[model samples]
Target: MDLNTAADAHALTPLLNCLLREVAEPAAEHGEGTHRLRGSGRLLRVRGGRRPARPELRRADGWHPLSHSELVELTSGELRRYTGVSNDELPVDMADSRATVAALLAARAQAAPPRDPYLLSEQSLVMGHPHHPAPKARGGAPAASWLPYAPEAYARFPLVFLALREDQVAEEGGPSAATAIDSLADALDGPRPPAGYRLLPAHPWQLELVGARRAVREAFADGRLLRLGGSRLPAWPTASIRTLYVPDPAADLFVKFSLDVRITNDVRRLWRHDLLTLRRTDAAAEEGFAALRRTGSDAAWLADRGYRTAGFAFEELAVLVRDGLHAHVLPGATPLLAAALAEGEPGSPLARTADPAGWWRRYLRQVVPPVLELFARHGVVLEAHLQNTLVAFDASGMPVQALFRDAEGVKLLRDLDRPAAWQRLVYCLVVNHLMEIGGALAERHPDVSPFVWPAVREEFLRYDAARGLPETAELLAASSLPAKANLLLRWTRADGAAARYLPLPNPLRD
Candidate 1:
């Protein structure tokens, strides 16, 4: 495929898969070249599976081709017909997503990827959230507004710093938060905060978007908030664009900011409720990881250490400090984003591996055990999706450890019914995380694909035998896995936090 064709294909795959999986069903396949979209009874042809699949619709003349724009038009028409409800905004968002991918492709052509495997892995998600309809949409913002901060474009910039008056500072996880922020301040070269004000860091893009708000402006005028300046050191934006990685030796921490832009399903804001209950969730995760460690598991939890923000502009101004790689990673092991492993990046161990089966086995060993142990033993449901988990590989490029992050996504058993929690766990861990990685590996080595699911089944069985959990039998026997219905969720304009799932065929079943 040529460059533009390739980029369009990369952009269209997720959109088509989402439409097919959520709103339409697959009808009789026409050998290898064509299939049918069930709702409209329109025959279609596609070249891929659930991700980045190229699609075409059949017409009276012959097999008609669909570009990204044409695909959006088709999807909109099909959804309107299927639901009897039209979403004008969704079609716009879908178009915007395609445009954003085009922009990223253009920028990537001119930019040099980071040399560090970790940074490369973090920034390599050109096509993100494979099942989401509009993964790269930037809330309809202009490309210039977000390109400088985009991870896919390999963009990195310094954070803007602010000084919030002492009384206006609202924070939780006090000691840890203060220390982490203070460390960041020490490393940054910026204007000193005035006498009564404490240092508060702001995302430059966020400041540009929300600094003119009445509350923020009033604080600046009333000596409540002061613009200190930007930091000297640049932070690398991770796959989760709102979170940034600072490679400073003095203050090594991932700083997550509240970006007002809509990314995927939600506004990328660090919401007040999540911040208020963060410590509780984090404490539970820490306890859960501790218990898992006792089982001699090498899995680790990348704690969300703390957060700092102004009381006046809490969610908008909030910043979360998460544990950095240097502290948590195993010695002599290079850590990489699990999502990047599936997506493919420069210097990926998966792509370079000579022993696909052995590598896949090591990956399963590190990723599966901890998630199961934490769920069964501590009732801590980790959102162990590919983006939330990192795998550290030893010198031979075999996965040595699995590290999970993001406390905001964690749910304790007390908060949810066992069945619901188990479903969420199965969806996030098995469907979202394992399935993607396994598919990627399979593509690289189709011969080993058949063995992959059996190995995963075996791993779960062994864990079940040791733990004696009845849920294990159910999981192994289940005909379908819970797959999050992102397309439907967005179509109905439902709250992003409210996840709805549909049954997808369970590959783990015998």
Candidate 2:
């Protein structure tokens, strides 16, 4: 909370430093704006012109304003008021759960599911599509078949956390449902409860493919989903786990569940290993455009422009209760942009500001010239970031769409032989999404100074010198250690790159 004793950053630094010197200080000098504080004295007084306008019924449209009690009064309110416990404290009965079947056989003895990862009977999951549908001139009438998409009708149930308890489930039920649950623990678990038990609507993709894979265990020193939702829902505080917006009985979707198991099922198994690295980098850019079929090559010049791809199974994100017109546990679109950046107005210019030059101009117009026109017309490699990208925008704010999920993170070249699909697309887009969330946003936004890390390694060496990729300065000097560890691990990780909605500048632009 120290932006030198923040009082809304000294009441919005005098009209936010004259609106950041009228949008980026051109040699400063905007007077009339005021601020004054002197010496060991308490002269502290500041103004941003009477402010007050925020509450648009505490906003929440499109989401990304994180504020969990103003991030527990900015980071350490008694370590965010300790409220833990609840791996759904089993033994409600299933042959007495056996520690959820010995923690799912010690996480299927350290991972092994790949091979035919998920093409789900060869291509067909481009929800609400239209990639191209006019080709009839080949002798007339023969297009329009790629539109029907359905993952149980526009999927849902990704997360919905909550589960807490300590001691008293009548002194921890042990001996066969503890004597009929201590004489009907209030008609079988449901009244005057507190010193222990809560468990609300779980299902971060069934705790990552079943009650705890703590979203891919990844040890740090002997691990099997221990503590912090012990493989998926603990770390108390009245047993938190809030995110729950279920609704998608068939479509017009919505399902924003995540009482945080690293935002449910570990970011949905890191977006299913980046859609298996964009399906073997879209099948090695369709066998390098079928080896230049008649020398015209076009997997959309290598692939990335508004990239779109999807195929998720895990029993089509289960967990249902009821809600007429199709409600597969709805609510998402990042909790409506984290509830409109948590009721906007921290100097609100429609509060969704994100920088680093509109994330390198939409990763250089919808992902670096479509992976530099798929490595100069066919030798592919489209990784694209932010959980293998999604973005999607319209109503006028531009950026139309750009799905691109994982297929491990898609790479191809080495003369296209496909060395095990370019080592699982360079360990899931350079070691799990840009060096682990760009080293947690460079250890929590050290004042946003990652200077767009060498301007995205000089925009991938000017996109391999204007699209003639391959060995492009040895893959831009081996992609700067996962882009300097995701620009220093997404600035200390708890989803903060100023809470990720990104893309800015239009504060009424200039």
Candidate 3:
């Protein structure tokens, strides 16, 4: 396939998968080229199942292949007919998502990838959130506007520095002596702050988008905030687009900034309430990781150290500092994004492994135990979905560590019902994270597929004796696993935090 066709196919796969899994069912297959959509009684066909699905619609004359735009139109019409709910914006977003993927593909061709394996893995998620309909959509913004900051394009740029007046500064939590936010200032190549002002960094792209807001304008006008140019060191955007990684040898750190665009279901902003409880959540995660380490698991949680922002633009301008991989990673080991591992990016250890079964076992040993221990022993439910987890591999390309991040998504048992928290954990850790990796491995080594789930069950059994989790028996015996309904959630326009799940067949069940 040509580059444009290849890009369209990658973009169309997730959209079609979301529509099929969430809204439609299969009625019949005619040979390998045609099937019927159960909801609309419309005949359709695709090249693959779940992902990389190339859709075609049956017509009067013959089977008509649908382009990405045509597939969006078909999906919109089917959803309207199936649910009688008309959505105008989703179609536009769908088109925007396809266009964005095309732009990313084009840009990646011209740009050079980061030499660092970690950064390359971070930027490798060109086809993001494999199950979400509009994962790449940037709130319908022009591709030119966001491409400079797009991770998939391997784009890296300097941060915009700001000087905030003392009284206007708002912050929460405290940083460890080693990973303090103040240390970041030493690397800035921007104008010096005025004598009484404190240094704060803002994402340059975000500043361009929100600089015109009344609060930001007033702050600048009244000298509450001063623009001090950009940083000297370039920051690499990770898979999570809003977060950037600075590769400073002396003070390496990951800085997360608030972007006002809707990525997937939610607007990517640092909400005030999340910031208020940041310390509690982060402390819980740190404690949870420590407990796991005592159990001899090489799992770590990247601490979300303090944030700094103006009181008026708390969410929009807020910047969060996180621990860099250099300090936390195992000796002689390289960390890679778990999602990229599943998706089979260049330099992925999974792709290069000589022994798939042994590698899979090592991966399970590193990943599963820590998550289960944290949930049962510590009451900390990590959002251990593929995107949030990082798998570090030793020199031999065997899995050596599993590191989890993102304090915002953590749920404590004290805050949520234990049963509910366990369910969410199962969904995030198993259904969303492990299943994808297992599927990728199976695709690579179909001969060893039979051993996959049996091994997972054995791993669970190893933990069952000590923790005795209430859901243990049910998890092993359940007919279905909870799968998040991303398509329906977006269709119903529900709050992003309000997750609703549908039951999918549990693969681990005997």
Winning model by TM-score: 1
lDDT of 2 by residue, 102-215 (tens): 222333234332121111111111110100010001111111110011121112122233222322111121332223222222222223323344322334333433343432
Please give each candidate's TM-score: 0.97, 0.22, 0.97
Off by over 4 Å in 1: 1-3, 50-52
Ranking by lDDT, best first?
Answer: 1, 3, 2
Put down candidate 1 lDDT per residue, 1-510, tens digits, no spaces: 666776687778888778777776655556564556645878877776546365778888987778999988887787777777879898899989888988999999999998888999898898888898898899888999999999999989998888899999888886877888877777567667878888898888889889899999899899898878878888989999999999888888899999998899999899999998999999999998888778788799989978889988999899999988888888999999999988866458888789999998899989988888888888899999999999999999999999999999999999999999999999999999999999988887788988889989988998888886678889989999999999888988889989999899999899
Give the Cα error of residue 167 in candidate 1, in Å.
Answer: 0.7
lDDT of model 2, residue 377 = 67
On residues 1-510, what C-alpha lDDT tens digit does candidate 3 reach at each position? 777897788788888778767776565556663556655777888875446476778888988888888988888887787777888888888888888888999999999999989999999998899888888999888888999999999999998888999898888765462236667677778667788887888888899889999999999999999888777889999998999998888678888989999999999999999988888999998998887777677799999987888889889889998888887899999999999987778557887788989999999989988888888888889999998999999999999999999998898889998878988999999999988898888877787789889888877887787667667788999999998888778877889999989888898898
Q: Which regions of candidate 2 are displaced past 4 Å?
A: 1-376, 379-383, 388-459, 466-510
Output the worst ten-in-a-row residue range by lDDT, candidate 2.
Answer: 128-137
Q: Higher-lDDT candidate among 1 and 3?
A: 1
lDDT value, residue 81 of candidate 3: 78
Model 2 scores what on Cα lDDT?
0.28
TM-score of 1: 0.97
